[model samples]
Target: MTSPRKVRRVVSLVPSLTEAVAVGAPGLLVGATDWCVHPAGLDVVRIGGTKNPDVAAIAALRPDLVIANEEENRAPDLAALRAAGLDVMVTEVRSLDQAFAELERVLLAGCGLTAPPRWLDDARAAWAAPPSAPYPPRTAVVPVWRRPWMVLGSDTFAGDLLARLGVRNVYADHPERYPRVPVAELRASGADLVVLPDEPYRFTADDGPEAFPGLPAALVDGRFLTWYGPSLAGAPAALRAALRRAGPVPSPRRP
Candidate 1:
């Protein structure tokens, strides 16, 4: 009888999972995708991007386990890895609650941690729902991309995070998880605020705010709004601060 192989060396395809495992187990993560930027100064062999990882390179690393997300990773890649005889752990987190449960599973069951990581407990406490002080009501147009104009539509981790921050996504029932809506339609969607995050599309104060003429734009951190790792501990407070900065700036008085 052979015992199961331990997760000694891990490769994380999801940026959030990378940070979780890297911080929790330290040195267990040997490889990660190029996009795994958290815990800055993370020293590991860069395999490639999430959607298109270097399979050959990853196979060469001989990882005991590879962490990925249902959204960030592609099915074909997971299949190829499995075909190569490597164990792949995929996570799916559409809401705040699911994120917590999945994080615990990834850290303990997937990575073989003896107990729940401290960050998980701290994150749970940080986002313990029902609010300490009720924030003002807000209806927001949360755009994650531009040029093509994509928004946070139904059942997304970002949308759930925003909901907890006292902001309701205008397109929460758009049918598509991330629907491509026309800019003009978005402007007329009766959203009082535009919540833009600096990732998947870097929306700066100048770059994104101008699109919504009169709407207050809350430029929040994408990591805080999207990633479900150690950053979850600081996300609520950071997002609250960003939302407070929401206000429309008049366009330079038209020279």
Candidate 2:
């Protein structure tokens, strides 16, 4: 049998969770993403990105622990970090339920123990029953990029996220991991919201407007909505906030 783990100070390799832990679990993070702009005053050392992290820079931080995701960081990169004598914890989250479990695990590692707050279970339960009245399910096509256009299809974390938020996925019919298709397919999908993500490929409203003329399109913070890491604890609440901000869709009323 293997021995237990220990953690003192940590560096989060995942950008979305960097802010969540910065706000949710403070003073424990010593390293974060260059894109991690939360907390306003806390200065965290940058350790490159989820894809191409600077191992030398990370070694300089001298952290006792590191957090990474299976889908976010490639296998070779994770192997390199492990070879460097850094205790790395890797998580694979394919659904919102798995996302919640990841956040709890992070909390356990950060605190050097494995006890979870009771409220977490309650929080997950709250989502099962929508507050007030249930709104009409909105069909959304979340595009991560253009040019060899990619979209979140069935069995993906992004697709599961939409299901949790009461939004139906327009690309549930597609079977590919990240399919490349034409704009003509999008026009035929009849999606209510053409959500443009900010990462992998930044989609600005100006770029997608003409492509999705009559559709309700918006540039959304992809990390918060999609990344399943320690930040997942805040995602349900964040989704609710986004739903309120977007308000109700006038056109394409519920069928």
Question: What TM-score, computed on C-alpha atoms, does each candidate reach?
Answer: 0.93, 0.80
* Worst ten in a row by lDDT for model 2: 126-135
Estimate, for each residue in 33-77, the C-alpha lDDT of model 2 and write its tens digit: 776666567698888877889988887888887888887778888
Model 2, residue 65: what's the lDDT?
Answer: 79
C-alpha lDDT values of all predictions: 0.89, 0.70
**Mind giving the per-residue lDDT tens digits that candidate 1 earns over 77-182?**
9999999999999999999999999998888888878778898999999998556322466888999999999999999999998887778899999899999999
Clashing pairs in 2: none
lDDT at position 203, candidate 2: 78
Off by over 4 Å in 1: 1-5, 129-135, 247-255
Q: What TM-score, to 2 decimals, does candidate 1 have? A: 0.93
- Identify the candidate with maximal lDDT: 1
Query: Cα RMSD (Å) between model 2 and the true structure?
Result: 3.9
Q: How close is candidate 2 to the true structure, as a TM-score?
A: 0.80
Error at 231, model 1, angstroms: 0.4
Give candidates' CA RMSD values in order. Answer: 3.8, 3.9
